[model samples]
Target chain A: MSADATQRAPQGRTLSAAPGSAGLARRAWPWLVAIVAALLLPWLFFDWSTHRHSGFALTMLSEIGLMAIFALSFNMQMGQAGLLSFGHAILFGLGGYCAAHTMNAVKAGAMWLPVELVPLVGGLGGLLFGVLFGYVATKQRATAFAMITMGLGELVAACALMFMGFFGGEGGISTDRVIGISLFGVSYSSSWQVYCLVVAWTAIAVLLMRLQTQTPLGRMANATRDNFERAQFVGYDPRMVRFCQFALSGFFAGIGGGLYAIVYEIVTFDTVAAAKSATALLAAYIGGAGGFFGPFLGTIVVVLLQSGVSLLSNAWLLYVGVLFIVMVMYAPGGLVGIIAQHAPIARAGRLRELIVPYVRILLPGAFSVFGFVLLVELASFTTIGAAQGKAFKIGPQAVDPATAFPWLLGAAALIGGGLWLRLEARGFRARWDALMADAKAKGVML
Target chain B: MEVFLVSLLNGLVYGMLLFMLASGLTLILSMMGVLNFAHASAYMLGAYFAFTISQYIGFWPALVLAPLLCGTIGAAIEMYGLRRVHRNGHIAELLFTFGLALIIEKVVQMTWGLIPVPYRIPAGLDFPLFTVYGTQFPAYRAFMLLISALMFGAIWLGLTRTRIGLVIQAALHHPEMVGALGHNVPRVFTTVFAAGTALAGLAGVIGGNYHVTEPAMAFTMGPIVFVVVVFGGLGSLTGCFIASLLMGLIQTFAVVLDYSVADLLKWFGFTVTSATPFHEVLTVPLPRIGALLPYVLLVLILVFRPRGLMGTRDT
Candidate 1:
């Protein structure tokens, strides 16, 4: 599946770029802008009125950066290598645990390591586990590989619980990051300081991963992913390519885990759990595994939903699951692929042609989403919320769920809005088809 | 002796429940090349549906109705959801099911509340069936064994005896050939998927009461079922049965074995002190490690014998 998507990747690039060095520069520009943006974001979001930092914002931003690295690392196996690892977070978690240990050692003055280089220690720890497990995991392909990774993940997670010295059992290992160690004589005491560290590591990790995609090893990994037989016939050991890629992916994931440990000052079994692995998969796939920055965007969007949406409702995971299913079913190339598909049309200045159609589709679409959310929330409120002594309140009105009025409204909105959305969607499809034909006639191709 | 007899019976019951779930998964994985990650979720739904139905109409009627309901839901999902995603590839199908599993868990929680429903065996069958070494064996367990045995017989007969079963068997081995032979392959796919889910639902009906019908039961059982299917290898029912029974026995026996690796090492005069390397790993009791056994075995099997015991296909 990924093989088919990667085959069309160059075509995606061709829509917006000229060949040669100009295209290279165009590609490189995003990385530079991303780095600059990462560096400037904390300052940009500074609170002037309080005369104090927005620690929450900084922490959230740091989480995004950390998740971005994790997702990107995951994509190395998933998109580029076509190895769907079900246990990618083991490396991340192991790295975090190792980093936590390092933090403790540094705090005890038993180690002279600087705090800035802690993530590298984590990366090395990840690489160690990655190589060890990758040797076994990379022996198989596809489903078997995925299963083996899951087994390994479970094994490590179980061990993490069993061995308390290194893993610290259920409560996990915690450490103080403000251990009087300085990188450039800066105490690194504040969340912003940690956020800066995360941003720097994220930038480095992203750049390294992007660079890896251009290397011979990366190209071979893609070739191996596409066809193991073909790769083998061409004198490349597909297993070796997979192993190296897996190890490297683990290394980067470990770095992300290190950042997580450093920021949180703790590492636990949750870090290496299958759920954590699922998070990486969701982020990478939702963002567009086919694109370099797709997971980056996915990380931001998912982290926002996780941190932002979860505060208001307990159905955040439900929403993410729904979004993922929708993406997989309808848009396998993900968010970036959807956007990239319109590049030629946008470049031809015919983008406005679909505005009416988009509005037509989106109006009922919004209604459907709202209806669905309302139904889910009401159901949740009736069952769980009521039991918890929380009333269902919307603005000034406290709606009693026992009444049939709200239920009717929810059902009608869902069924009615869904039907209307279907109708509008057909109209939008017709308009889109017409616009595509027009674009084709105007010498614009997608 | 009583402990051994009881553990054996319990193991058999649990193994059969696992087989009911794993058999469907094996068929889906081998025939469609799509691992239905939401298979356990289907089981969860069956339990929830049975719980609700039994509350209204009693257990006996629910036993017949809940699986049928699940079969219908499974058919709808296959027709609308899996069929749409099938064009994309197996990975998409897998992800779709994975997402479905998540949604189902959440939906189950929302609809049924967060707590486990008091879904219990019927009073008619709640009494002890027999006494073994002065220990009473529950009649519900005997019923579970009977139902599972009946299901096994039915599935075996249907697959080997019926016309549709022949078509399904043919489809499993040669899907493209079956398609070329003017068979409605999509219909067959849907039927197989529905049948698989129905079997899972049936397992849920029995297993839920045997264990507990809760929101978290799906997640807890999901991985174990996957391990069974993988350990048995893909596309082989006999292997699945063997793996399930072996896993069941291992888990049950592990729980009963109070000894640790330290005990074993003591026979060789090796004392496991606190300062000793891997002391926790060595001293941890067998029952404490029971949860990790299946995963460890799964890894070992995948690494060593990828085709699994009696499996014709490599997973």
Candidate 2:
């Protein structure tokens, strides 16, 4: 039915990166730019006096890189095949364990393997398990598919905790990343060196995933997603398509996990936890699961919110959850979808026409958002911060949550700003509709 | 034998709680085709609300009011949230609920803090009810059973005797046709969802003190309830009840038995020493892997029988 919905809304942009009329370079520029940006990111955070990158910045960037792969792989099942897997971390974590174990084996002098290609070992591990699990899980589709995946995830996580021989129990398995076996003689001792590996692998994984969408397997996946019965009628086994896509997605997820094991020098049961799976889902959905690069973009933002925002406030998850729900209800297309939706107007030279309307909405939107955040943070502070002996302060003044003043100010701002935003949103919508109409009349929008 | 009896009694209490939560989820999953991921979150909310209300009022009033408040919240979520996402399709709706679950957890944290609240068993029911195998069974367990049994009877009477229940039953089987017959199917959905959540809330009110009233409780209990629903088969209340009890007994027995496949194998003359391949799995105790059993059962059932026992629909 969801597939049917997507089919009905086909404005022929299912394959947004149409190979026709566009040169290869034009289509490839985004990747090129992204790669350059990623390469320079760590250096921008480098400390000249210490001759080192800020460990936090490097770690965060590396997380975004690998998590981008993970989130994208999650989308392979979700957006591509219309299969919602609740336990994607089964593959990701399994891959990490395999990679970690292999790394340990190398350290123990049992096997000689390049440290650089460890992600492939992880990929293989993921593929094998994906094949095994996908065989069982792909037997059912829709809701059942989700349930089975969830069960499988929980099963694996439980196993990870119980099986100390492999999972290493609560403390988890840790390793030194300076496994001197790289082709380039890169010992991978430094965090910067590991970050480079992450960047390279992330690039490869992203490129391969992008190319996968242009392949027959990818098309069949989309075909099955759009209409399962029709795909079956067209002599394609929707089950087989789902199975292959599931396995391949696992391979990519495993690669991400492999990199995770390397970057962190450990893989814990947390890798396979249900929360880990939720992270992928959050990234993919919030980024807008519709586009190839949507989840990739979403992963970057989600990881930032997770790693960066948590520093300032204990209510980061609340922010992410609120953002997620708001995105689901209002912007189902996600960040990528939002951008894709506006591409036509941007191309039509009438893009500037939306500036006034946008300003009208942004002011009140900011006001309400600020109020919401303040309220949420204050609420969180009373419970967590106050317990930790951290007082809620406004510059020189310490604010008390038990007092009525802050609460009233927060409530008043929230209510007033919400009403103002609502009023302005109406006008914004009208203006946006008119612009869209004008653009469509000018043969700009598809 | 004493251990068996005590575990059996304990399992019954746990099973009853699981059924209360799974019942609502089974209804939502089997009928509406929307898995209410926040069902357990609603249960958590009930505990929180009950705890706060119990502090101000008392446990008895809190028990009655908490579920009602949860039901109201469920109704609002259905009307405002699920209704909007319903047009987008099941995946969107699922995501919406998933987001709701996360939000509920965060909200619970923000409001109550991360610590477990003092939602304890009331003094009246805190005493032991009876001696079972020389061990006293707490009166709280008995109270849980009594409440659940009373709830079951009420639900049975209401559904069997009322016109609205008849409409709901019909709508469950034939939602579109029922809608065509001038019944508000969405309203039925809202009512059922609210009822289901309220049931979960009621379970929380009873079970929270028995366990712990904490935000993490929702997540810990969420998956097991799901496993129950899937095992019981979709759209079948009878199957759900049976599955819930079966899982409860299995989980409880697994913990108490202290038996393992290693022991069984040892009886069969195959010693599972550390020298043996995969010794870790072969020698692991049942209690160690108790958490894995329900999920293992779930996957096996899903693979072998898409439609659970007595299931009308292929889940």
Candidate 3:
């Protein structure tokens, strides 16, 4: 079945770069501006008028930055190499552990090292582990790779418990980030400081990863993802490409882990658990798997859901699950993909022409979303509410349990909105098909 | 010797229980080419459903009803959820199942709470069946063994003697040919998924009382079941059976044997003391090794033989 599926998929033919003169300066400006903006971000937070000028926001931002790097690293494997790993936390956690232990050793006067260099130790640690495991894992692709990674993850986690000197048994390791010498007399004591450091590293890593996508190695990895035999026939060793990608991914993941250690001031088994790995997978996929910044956008959205949504409902997991399912079924390319579908229309100066259809489709979509949220919130209020021994109260009155009005209304909205969406989708497709046919025929005349 | 015999018996019982679960899993994995991360979640639901139903009716009815309920649920999932996600690709299907497992875990917790419920062995099978070295083997264990053995026999008979079983066997080797022979492939997939989940549910019905019925039980058992499936080989039931028995014996004997590497070293005229650099590892007890053994076995299998023991193709 898989062999047939692979055969049916278009082989990795190079995509025609959108025909245009080289926009070297235009492409370079966004990254340059982003780097400068990242550098000034910490300082900007010091302004009193800014709402996010606080310790908590800075810490949250740091966490987001770190996780974004981790997600990008995961994208390298899943998006580029076509390996679906569920145990990426092995690399991330090992990186954190290595950094923490190194910090501890430095504190004990066993070694003298600056905190800036500590992340390198962590990166090297991840690199070593990845190479050792990736050697065996890279021999097999797809499901076998996933299985091997899972086994290695479990082994490492179990060993962490057995060996207290390394993993600290379960409590993990804690160390002060201020132990090592500060760069340029900047004391690395505050979350804001860590935020600046992480953003700087994240920007660099993203830049490096983007460049990698343009490299021969990256192209080979893409080919390998399409077909190992094809890659072999083309004289590129698929295993070597996979191994290199895996190790580089570990480097970035390790940096993310170091930031984790720096932010939380502690590292534990939870940091490297399979659940954490699953979260990375979720974020990368939710963002869109094809583009460079897909995981970055996904990270922001997921972290928001994790931080903000969890406060209102314990069923946040249910919502995320539903979102993932919807994405897989309807929007396999993710949020980026949904947006990308309209790109050509906008490029052809027909942007305004679709506004009516867009709003028409969006209204039903919004209604459906609202209805879905209502159901989730109501369910949460019932289950988690009932669990917490809280009653369903509205203002001064507790709602009667026997009434079916709320459920009926929600159901009506769901069914009605869903039907409206189907009707709108048909209209949208008809218009889109007409536009495409016009473009093709006109291009021939031109 | 008595302890050894008792542990061996216990291992055999555990192995049989695992066989009930792994056999179903191996079939579904091989035929459908999905790992079914939610298989253990389905097992968990079966136990909870049986517990709930037993309150309304009785244990006997629940033993029959819960599996039917689970089978229907499995068929619905395969038809609606899996088939939809199947279009995107295998990884997406896996992710969907993974999410489904997460949601099911949460659902079980929301419905049943976090505490382990009292799902006791039937009163008829509560007494001790045998005594060995002052250790009593409960009649419930014997009944479990009997049920599992009967299940194995029934499955074997069904596969060997039934037409559907013949189709399934042919599908294992020549899925395309089976389809060409007028078998509805999608219907077969749905049936296999339902049957596999039903088998898991059956195991849950019988084993829930023997183990604790809790929300966390699925997570605890899920990985071990995966280990069995992977270690056994992706496309082979006989390998699954042997792997299950091997794991069962390893886990059972690991708890039974009260020795460490230090003990072996002492027997070899090398007295290990606390001062040794490797004392932490050498002196660690055998029970701790139990948890690590499955992963060790997994790594070894993945590294040395990616295709597994009875696999026709690499998983």
- Model 3 per-residue lDDT at B102: 81
Every candidate's chain B TM-score:
0.98, 0.97, 0.96
Give the per-residue lDDT of model 2 (tens digit) for B90-199: 88898899999999999899899898998899888888878976899998898899999898788777777998888877876788899999998899899999999999
Residue lDDT tens for model 2, A1-446: 33233333445554554666664666778888988998898888889998878999999999999899999999999999999999999899999999999998988889999899999999888898899899999988888899899999989888888888889999899976777788789999888888889999999998999899989999999999999899999999899999999999999999999999999999999999999999999999889999998998889889999999898688887888888999999999999999898866665557788889889889988888877887988888887877887778665887887898888888888888899999999998898888788667766665
Flag the better candidate by DockQ, 1 or 2.
2
lDDT by residue (A1-446, candidate 1, tens digit) is 33335336657777767668978898889778977887777777788998777787888899999989999999999999999988999999999999999989999989898889999999999999999999999999888888889888888888888888889999999988887877777677888788878888998998999989999999999999888899999999899999999999999998998898999988988999888999999999899999888998888889999998777667888888898988998899899999988865664566788898888878878877877888888888888877778778656798988888887887888788899989988888887777677657755574
- How well does candidate 2 reproduce the true complex, by DockQ? 0.82
Native-to-model Cα distance after best TM-score fit, residue B188 in candidate 3, in Å: 0.8
How do all the candidates rank in terms of DockQ, highest first? Answer: 2, 1, 3
Cα lDDT of model 3 overall? 0.81
| lDDT (tens digit, per residue) of candidate 3 on A32-100 | 897777667656557567644567557667777889888998999999999888778888889999999
* DockQ of every candidate: 0.75, 0.82, 0.58
TM-score of the second chain in candidate 3: 0.96
Between candidates 1 and 3, name the one with more favorable lDDT. Answer: 1
